[model samples]
Target chain A: MKLSCTIRKQQYQFSSVREVLGKASEEKSGDQMSQLSASSALERMAAKVVLSEMKLEDIYENPVIPYEKDEVTRIIYDDLNLTVYRDIQNWTVGELREYILSHTTGRPELSRISRGLTSEMISAVAKLMSSIDLVLASQKMRHQAYCNTVIGEPGRLAFRCQPNHPIDDPEGILASIKEGLSYGCGDAVIGINPNNDSVESVTRLLRMTHEFMQRWEIPTQNCVLAHITTQVQALRNGAPISLMFQSLAGSQRANEAFGVNKEILDEAMALMLRCGTASGPNVMYFETGQGSEVSLDSHEGVDMQTLESRTYGYCRHWKPFMVNNVSGFIGPETLYDGRQMIRADLEDLFMGKLHGLPMGIAPTYTNHMHADQNDQEIAGMLTALGGANFYMGVPGGDDVMLSYQDTSYHDDASLRELLGFRPLREFEKWLEKMGIMENGRLTERAGDLSIFD
Target chain B: MKQIDLDHLVQRVVEELSKKSQEAIPFPEEKELGVKNPHNREVLEQAMRRTPARIGIGRAGTRMKTTSYLQFRIDQAAAHDAVMKQIEPAWLAELGLPELYTRAKDMQEYLMNLDSGRFLSEESVRWLEQNGDKHKDVQIIISDGLSTSACEACIPDLLPSLLQGLALKNVSVAKPLFIHRGRVWVQDHVASIVRCKVVISLIGERPGLATAESLSAYMIYQPNESTVESDRTVISNIHRGGTPPIEAGAYLADLLADILRVQASGVAYAQLRVK
Candidate 1:
């Protein structure tokens, strides 16, 4: 019997680092000059970085463990990526290989590793002949390690220095740089709040920062420059402003005020538009004002309608050419009654439930010094209900500490908070609480429909 | 007048009708009904659970299981876009950004009113200027916690983190936007404003009987008008048995890197298909 040999070509091919390097070197030698021209300068830099970061020796030297994928593992993997939802424990080496081959779409460039797979498996997969690119690293530590392996110890650490802070001293900066460089710190950031800062101080600080980064051989792009402002100040200052409130009444009031303050707002917005183009920081947030001392009378003064109107009007008038992220703060009124806070009309108006925000930042908890367990839960639940991109205040407590131990403790607490909401576990708990049993068979009852249904 | 069979049948029918006429039928509205096929009902129930029936400023980042696949995809898309598009995440500082900007602007106007009557958050015509630049993007994730209560309690602390995280990320956040009344859609809308490729919302999914304050990540990629349910992904049920929050943050960064890798979001580039 004669077998057919098929030759296929495809677009968007993944080139190996070695191949790229060989071409680059040959170009330098005046040979293979035609092939070397395809890559742009940035692409070459990226290629060099990728090549230097990962070593073949490390990949092959890593251990591979024999493991079986279990039911729980399967679920986790499927949750991570829907493409591989079936049980793989029963598959033999041949079947596994075949499965991998089929899943790759014959690209020979990509690969997959399910969520629950062992680190050893990941290491093994990283060594495959076809696995020249696209390594799957699940954990943060793993990703960091991968970067380190490829980047080969950034010659110097990147740091953002704020002059006012005690830690921003030259000695402190040097020490921090030493620690990061020796320990493989990928990035360091510094925040400068201009309220209490001086231009002279900032200039000196920026110069020092720039010099330090340059001496350390860190790229300037790694150093980020930013300025922060608030909505009230933006409006008062001159920027077109929008208001975010807990109720519609506050929104309306703000809107009416916008009309009154149009001239001021336009001037402010126009200036902001100019600044935004140059600085690339143009976003606004409206938060319902809250008083630490909660009182119904004081809360009543916080009108939601007027606030919404103000926000709507501002957003409409300015046609804010670009918005980075928009959000509002939860007011004391929401805290008064948890049940009342989830009102449908209020959620729709506030969130634009029909439309989604790219960066929706909500609070998890506040008043850490005074909060109870119920309050914390409410914070976590609100995050889920609201649909946020990042949960910033996952673990907040104990008078706000800047020390390492405190931050670690807070991180642990936050992690614990997240674990409570695991999906399948929650699903199982719901089933058990309702006293309903499943036998793997689909059946229907002739009874009345459920409210949820 | 009829035959024996017809007479018997008529007698039986009359007896049944007389017996039933004395009892009153139960009303359908009053009866409590339970779901029989939970699997079939799960999609509907989950959707309902995620939706807010009435509008009110509830807790931020509460009752969201963002870690779930469905949720995280949605959250991430919005977050990436916020960064790429240059939109600032909301800040939870006292009175939030709007008030702060307004106060600062007012101070500027007060200084400028000697020459003119008005000033704004964008104008720098004051004796005292803001601590930072014009419009920086600060990506933040606030959770209402297990329910709406957590948001009310955690917003304060969340604000500090936003500042810290921004410092850590090395990018100045735009005037931090507060999402007082938040939901999944907030992320998408924010991304559009920010022009970032995606955004992740760290939220609290509804708690079960045993656990409260379970946090989640609702991620979205390229959040905009074209974004559908399929465009969103979730890393949910992030309480105890699920992925931890800090770990989630780290993992989230990795996903962000991945998002950067393919430049495609949601289901499109989340996974690497091996052949």
Candidate 2:
């Protein structure tokens, strides 16, 4: 394989495929923290050149982590459509990028090609594309899933109304849910990140959210973002659960750190199928971030972006209802600043879409990171333009319980209006009935939680 | 006067001026409803009272009202400042904590490099080898993880309560050490040096717009090569607004006692308790 590239009079050499992939990645603090990134800009460009020339078969042959050692690599390899892989075996990464961006290549072609591509190839092509390239390619693919409501329809966006409270206060969570609903958010899921992860607490929140959904007849799903074990326990105790939630990483070690494995996820999916309140199939919701593997010391040697792509590969095995990417949630050690955060969000949206998943972008930022509300808003708008299926709608863009800023209720409404998109068909009708939204715009009666009363 | 004394005097004057300026223009209370006449004003007020979320604040079109917007920005600014600010040396002295340093040369290095904040500096390691209490039942560490404001606000109250609680439990604790620019994993290093059965680090959490004063306690028992993140038990959201510092300290003492009795921590401890 070509491991060296000469750009303008400088020669750059990477020792291995993993090094080339890591070096070719867009600059983020996580890779630099792990000391795996390119040492200089010229070297990065060189790595990209080398990566672009490499064929898909090369990446397929050299998994970042050996398949024998890592279950994540095994899952990704074992799930490959070998017939499709043989068809695209000789295509270079550069050719793959051009083919993906070609006008001839729409969702049908892209979806077919996606079966042959590995996560490394996805990461490779993404590294070679500019921000606009990412946005344009992302806009071409829109994957849909169904649970309580259908997500990722054309000309529609959805939001997970994340109404979290510090102490798992039921009334506080309910109040935020009403506020979110008033603004035409929560069509994706009315999810809460509970402070208490006990089975009893999880069950109580599930019961409360389920009861609220029943009372108002909201056209959305409900979830408690607790540990999967706790949620499983809650389900066993006969709690009402619409969607099961878990945070997944790219590596087996990281998933183990999260107290989850393929068996556990498989069991959860089976249980949700049997006992979950949501409609047929697509009952799992997953949250992924770029830096989790690095922070947990589980990335091995792969770059953050590649690890993120691998996470998508693992996530697709479950056929999740929603795959929310929160690349900036880990703080400065991973993303560094607003620019890096925005780049990560764009890459994740495009990659997740290409992997045939219902993807949402949580263009989020912690106060400690050098990103502000403006940066987050820009990311939200750009990803929305990139055809993200949904975003997290926190009250006022501030998640008091999680202590980060994401797309807010106002941002959720604005994205729909800006894109000339309405809510999910069912949700829009429900909004019209509530007199909060009309003609794809929020009315004067909107943003007032008292309307629910 | 000495140069340090002059610097302190200047800081004091600046602080006083800021206080006076804050008093001059009294900001509207948080309790004031920002929404214009709602369909049901009483219910909106009650809803706003329930969660710290910015609800019931009527939007001007698809954006927040000016007051609500500024309030959010101001809180975000405070949280950013909290992350960047340094804890005062005099405050650490007052708390009687011997200071230790991590390998990070500055805040940028500390934030960007995980390993820089995870290990002690050469001088700090030497100091620990010389002066650290050895073979104690427990070791206490306090760090400005991401928010120094959290340490400044919560430690004064939390430390004393924790000490008292430990005393009541008859648990022998080493003299608590303060490490600058430290992360949670640094506690494992301190534990290795002190040879404690268990180590607890009260570190500042990543600041939120709601409050930059939140702290978290991470307790690990005999951290070794096999220890993963799940090996350490954590209690977070310790602050005036969340779990009050005093209450958190007492609860942490009880938790530490339980861990010691079980001879485990984190997931292992939880599983053992279930059994």
Candidate 3:
């Protein structure tokens, strides 16, 4: 197919589909760090023009990383529905973008088409969409998954109450959990990132959270975001685990760096199904970001955005209950500033939804990056408007242990009010019974942790 | 009314306003609970005492109350400023530290480009070759990493105690040098030049809303091309709020002595100790 285009009398030639995809992507510091981004604004536009004319079959035939060498590529190809692929193989990337945004393309048609598209194809079309384009297209597709409580149902939003502690103090963690619950923020899960990753520490934190949930009769899940192996040992030791957590990368080498493999994940999922506290099918919670592969030095030659999509492809294998995309978590070296962070958030939300996963946006920023609370709020609002399934609820938007900022309990409550949404069905009832939430709004008795006393 | 009387009245109002402004209410302390009329205030206060996470801050209709909102902003602003601010040159000179620089030309380059902060400049390399103390048992490096405020706050107290601890142990320590806009990996380069067995880098951490003066020490034993992240041992959150600088200094010295004895650092050291 054509791989060259002339814009403003400047002919730009791309040698491969990988080159075109990288250059056509929006400006990102990670891609620039790898020296894969387009050199100039005009050249970027030229690459996008060339990519728009390329057919779906062209990208399908040429994966960025070859299928034989990469497990992520193999998993994506192995899981594709070839029947659906053959029907739309000849459509141009430009046509695919329009079809996704068309008024008639509802959730059913989008879901059917999603099974055919590879992760590369999803990344390709996302490069052509603007901020609003990503949001509008993302709004049409909402994928639901179930654990103890249902996630991603229409007109319902959820929050993972991330009550992290710096020293793995159980009493401190329980206190934060109480505070989050009073704000009606713990519908998705009460996931804690422990400073200590030992099996004993993970098991202790899990037991504490599980006991607290039971004591309050709260309709939620409890998770300790230690390494998957550590969680497995904890589970074997009889700790109550509601959701299994792991940080995923797009490539095999990067996954290796993270000390995870497909085999390990498979065994973990089987264990969760057999003995975990959560009910059925979706028991995994994954956190993915764009620059992880590059930072780990495992992104062979692919762009950050494309690698992130491949991560989603690998993630959907477990049928995760929550896929939290934390694009700006690394630093300015990856996202550069608020604009880039916001862009990555929108793109990740849309891509995860297109992959038929229950997606959440963390919309996080570190202190070193040139981002503040305003930029994070903008991302949270835009993704919430785009029908994101869930978000993280840190206390006052600060994670003391992780040393980053995420959506806070106040932001979580405000998102529901802004979108006229409610928490999960069971959680809303619990909040009403406790006099914390009514008519999808927090009541007068909310925002006081002592109410639990 | 007469114009003169009106002018006098306006002057008196301005003076009264200035006096009232000068009597400004002190900003609310972070420890003071923000929740109003809790069901059990004692329980809320006890919970607030447990963790530094911002809880018990009552909300205004699904938003932070005005005082709490401003407090969060002020803390965030301090963190941002810490990353952007530079360590004072006069202070570095006062410590008798020979200054070096990374390849980064400015703060923007250092923040955005990882490689720029990973290696020394040509001038710095030559300066080290000419003047650096070589073949020592340990070489210490101080860098103003993400937060220069951290270095400015902790080094004066931390450095003296660390040197005293090392001297008491009779460790052959090289003169410490300060590197501007450098990351943890720069210590490897310094080690390669000075030919030290153990190299330690006391660098600033990315400022969090809790404290901007936090620092971290990354120690590596005989860094080579094969050295991975696990080869380096890190002791983080060295600040007044977390681990006090003076205490971290003595602790690091003792840890260095252990590393020298075991011939390892990081995971290897931990494993060997267990064995």
Candidate 4:
């Protein structure tokens, strides 16, 4: 009974650990499973237990819920972001920090809180905070923002590059990789969006990319953007599985497209915890866009931005490495253009950050979306100034396969120069070794094409 | 993501099956000729600001303004040019890309007979027999479909990314070829001649006043004689003004890889059950 209750508490965050534990204490007999199913609050949430119907299942296991897990989901999806953001609009860093901390029980140990403001609020706050007090805010945000790529600690800005190759072309891919590294790309991780949808193709690319990174002596990890099952299969097959990746949206039908559900996600999270490239438990990378829910047509009457926030809520369970908000990638039918994109980018960042996600801003744009690199760069700048946890290090800020322009190596350098942010720690060492970085600064020769030659 | 395409597929199926059947497909709801404003005056202005469409333009003494009239004339002229303009053969020659012509001999003939625009000429077939090599796993065909400007504008940025991405995948690619007057279905012809796994057709989209230089990439996994229309997929609205040319090229690399791996394209690939 205690184990089942604990599982229910973790899976169905609508109820608190206190509620589950409190109810568990009400049972006269320790093994009384009937008493466990009696609560109205739990009846709705009990379905989350995978073996709820299995009368003889081993429901009793680890009943100890971690401190961070306890508070990972609280006051989320309550239509609370705007009210809370409005309440704290004028509060100072210390005051706002204290209020947020007070709300979360797992303080000091866990760096992020799962419940908080929307990206809409964050972007507005970003613009408002851009000119006033960036250093202190960034410091606080950095402290609480996702993983610190330097080691696995929080504070330092994390980043990754996706050298989107056509389809398993080693020469072309290596050229792009060399070019990216020459320009000092690949801070958080170096991943590829494999064009092939087959699981075998993805596994091959993951293995190949991992070996390439290791051979190059680059500290960053690698991932192959493939279907969820393909990634899971690769994990079991002894293929180098970096952070497992997937494009997630709030709608059920959206995930159904990729054959994913909460069960699959939780299962993948479990598998990656065992085998993924690890500094710690966090080893998932999720890409999300605002318009995806509506784009999938399973919006369930929820607005796009709200649905996007719910994706983070679902993601927090895995304690992901980062959530890349693809604000402008969807196009005009959803967001229309640059102005809407800018707003959406801010909202995505704010919400993800609020939900305690290690948030990265891709600030992507496509020609079909009626926007360009310039528009994307502008959005990146705003989000960077807002202290987004990380940014994309794609080649030339262009993804050949995904068909969107994000932050390029030069763009990262410019952001660093303008924003005073540095790459993750290990990548910083590699940069210094290559003489691309000196005294934590990009040299004049930073993007010289001669490096590749 | 493949998921979006699948979800989009399901929704499209429902929409197609449910809509009242007719001999001709209607222009989309958004493509109606006149302005329809039911929102408040202030709200209408806000809506107009968000889109490029000419909306919220109040009547000028019950007649359109000179500025609006001039703008309409400009758009109409650009549309005319988009349809009539021919992609110079010299353009392809300078790029050192291989070139070909469809069976269609002229623009008027091409317009009148869609079938003529979708097949290669006898001489073109002979040329392919000599030059076709399976060294490249993917074949790219650049064509002037409905808007030549789109073809011209996208080539500079799109080609490098596509080639670079393909090279990264180490997927061998044959020398790119062009079509003087081609349609989306021409890819089947290219694939029939070239024994490659995939054929990508970068063709000009139907030009609109909003943007003339927009391109579309029509991809087929294994185009052959028995290929159905459902066996094709596309990434469209590509240009500096739509989906960036370079980005689209890179995206195609990944899509091609997917097509090759799954050995399927279009509706089948999207609906393919992932293991």
Candidate 3 CAPRI classification by DockQ = medium
Ten contiguous residues minimizing lDDT sum, candidate 3 chain A: A194-203
Please name the candidate that would achieve the greatest DockQ relative to the true structure. Answer: 2
Ten residues in a row with the worst lDDT in model 1 chain A?
Answer: A139-148
Positional deviation of residue A182's Cα in model 4 after best superposition, in angstroms: 2.1
Report the C-alpha lDDT of model 1 over A1-453, residue by residue, as the tens digit.
011111233122224432323222201101111133225444433333332333323312221111131221222223333333233333322233333345443322212333322222222222221211221111001111111011101121112122122213343333223222211121222222221122233344444554554554432112112112122233233332121111111222232211223443455455444532122222222222221111111111222221222233223233221111111122222232222222211232222211112112222222211222343345334433333222222111111111000111122223324533221222223323322213211113211112112
Per-residue lDDT of B1-275 in model 3, one digit per residue for the tens?
A: 99999999999999999999899788875755777789899999999988989999988888998888888888888887778897787888888888999999999998878778889999999999999999998899999999888898899999999989999999999999999999888898999999999999999989988778888999999999767655777777788766689998998899899999999987567657646
lDDT of 2 by residue, A1-453 (tens): 899877898878788899999999988889998989989988888999999999999999999999999988999998889999999999999999999999899999999999988998999999999999999999999999999899999999999999998778899999999989999999999999987666788899999999998988888899999888778878988999999999999999998888788999999999999999988589999999899999988899999999999999999999999999999999999999999999999999999998999999999999889999999989999999999999999988888877899888988988888899889989899999999888998888888888888
Candidate achieving the largest TM-score: 2
Every candidate's lDDT? 0.29, 0.91, 0.90, 0.61
**Candidate 3: where is the Cα deviation over 4 Å?**
B1-14, B17-26, B29-32, B94-98, B126-140, B156-177, B191-200, B219-234, B246-275
Quality class of the docking in candidate 1, CAPRI style: incorrect
In terms of lDDT, the poorest run of 10 residues in model 4 chain A is A54-63
Better of 1 and 2 by DockQ: 2
Q: Which stretches of candidate 1 lie over 4 Å from their true place?
A: A1-269, A272-302, A305-334, A337-359, A364-370, A381-386, A390-453, B1-275
Candidate 4's residue-wise lDDT over B140-172, tens digit each? 999987778887889988999999998999888
Higher-ranked by TM-score: 1 or 2: 2
